[model samples]
Target: MSTPQPQTHQQAAPAPNWQSAPGTSYTSPIPITRTHLGHALTSEWTKIKSVRSTMWTLGVFLLLVVGIGLLVAANTDSNDYADVPYTIPAFFGLILGQICLITLGVLVVSSEYGTGMIRTTFTASPQRHRVLTAKLLIFFVVAFVVSAFAIGFVGLITSGMHGGASDNKWGGTVLMGALYVSLLGVLALAVGSMLRHSAGAITAMLGLVLVPAILPAFLMMSESLRTLGEKMTEYNAPNALAKIFELDSENGGGGSQLVLLVGVTAAAIAGAYALLERRDV
Candidate 1:
């Protein structure tokens, strides 16, 4: 009777299949696309244009440049241009307005870090160098364009009103000044990337831009350091821009300033890339 109870046979459970069957394939729901530098450029452009900091900084910059420039041009007498270049007044405004570009440049990269958006940026684009490059390129182009326009406008108005013989050099000087500002901005961007903090990066850039000019004045107390101080004052950012405007007669040509700025910017950019690759987001 016990032996007759049920067939006493149980079907064996099928063994689990860990591998896909031959000739079968699995498809993912997410679509994947290859990313390139253009994608990063577009992303950075969108970021720079969308942010309020960019608008506010650039707006103030334009106001300082154009407004002060016009005021200077209005106050100048035609006789004043006999000894001075028509474009000289533009420097009065540009020296102050250049700070705005430095601020914007720091904000461009540091703001993202401050807000934790950089993590998302890196997530979207894993190539840190590409992201940095895109940021530098976009910021430089925008800054240069805006600066060129502002400086050129001032030069045009002043030249028209004063009608100087050296008006021919206005265009070249404006171009050089704009490039100088743009390179300073790129340097700021590099510093921001290296620091990853808006306030710290901005402070560092301000020191970089202004300290050389100021420190040399105090250092003149020491006769031993007077030469060094003079050199710093001569080669500082303001002096560089002044040289371009033909305001600093003691300094050498703008070519040296441009070369120095380019070399410094290149070094900062290289350091930024190196630090970014080595650090965690």
Candidate 2:
């Protein structure tokens, strides 16, 4: 009897339902949410803040702007403020300081390309324009805020040192100067996006900054090109910043400079967007 019972092998019980119906969707235990521009912006902000280059570049910018401004102020008499706004000294520092900002702006995009991380970024976001927009917005805000703070600090200290010399609407000029530098940084960012090479993009930006200032002199020597050179000299980054800081009254006011920069930046940004969509990362 024991041999007969052993011959009847028991069949295993069927497993529980482990698969969903063909037409039904499974709800994941983890929360699933759609991504938006804010998420991309947050991601970009995190990336920008986490990198060492951001700190190094911005720190140098601050050092150049604040240090040189203070040094110039310390050496000059209060009477020097009679002809120009107290903020004039900051202009000298910003000329060099803007190079730091331009480098940072190029790094913002070109660095990702250099490391081949841009592919990962695109894979995660899948929306190229959104990513570019996030980069532009985050970079602009950061550049603007830091620039404004540095310029304002220098302006206040200089004014105090000069016994609040005639105001000359110094507060407004501080904001304008910050905006100008920030836009330049944005333009640099757009250029980086287009070039996708750090050194090349940076070199191009430097040309944009320094060429106009220097080339105009040689062009003016050639009488045929005098008007063209004049326009370039009038609208170059340094001249624009100088006008904004009230250091160059011979040139037109900062408003026209801002307008020219705005137009050029807009065109560059548009071109960047076009290239980003058509080209493979």
Scored by CA lDDT, what does every candidate get? 0.88, 0.92
lDDT of 2 by residue, 1-281 (tens): 35555567799999999888899998889998999999999999999999999999999999999999999999998888886777777888899999998999999999999999999999999999999999999999999999999988988899888788564778877889999999999999999999999999999999999999999999999889999999988888888887887778776668999998899999999999999999998
Candidate 2 versus the native: TM-score?
0.91
Candidate 2 C-alpha RMSD relative to the actual structure: 3.2
Give candidate 2 misplaced runs (Cα > 4 Å): 1-25
- What RMSD does each model have against the real structure? 3.4, 3.2
Which regions in candidate 1 have their CA more than 4 angstroms from the true location?
1-31, 163-167
Cand. 1 TM to true fold:
0.88
In candidate 1, position 233 carries an lDDT of 80
Candidate 2 lDDT: 0.92
- What are the models' TM-scores? 0.88, 0.91
lDDT of 1 at 136: 95
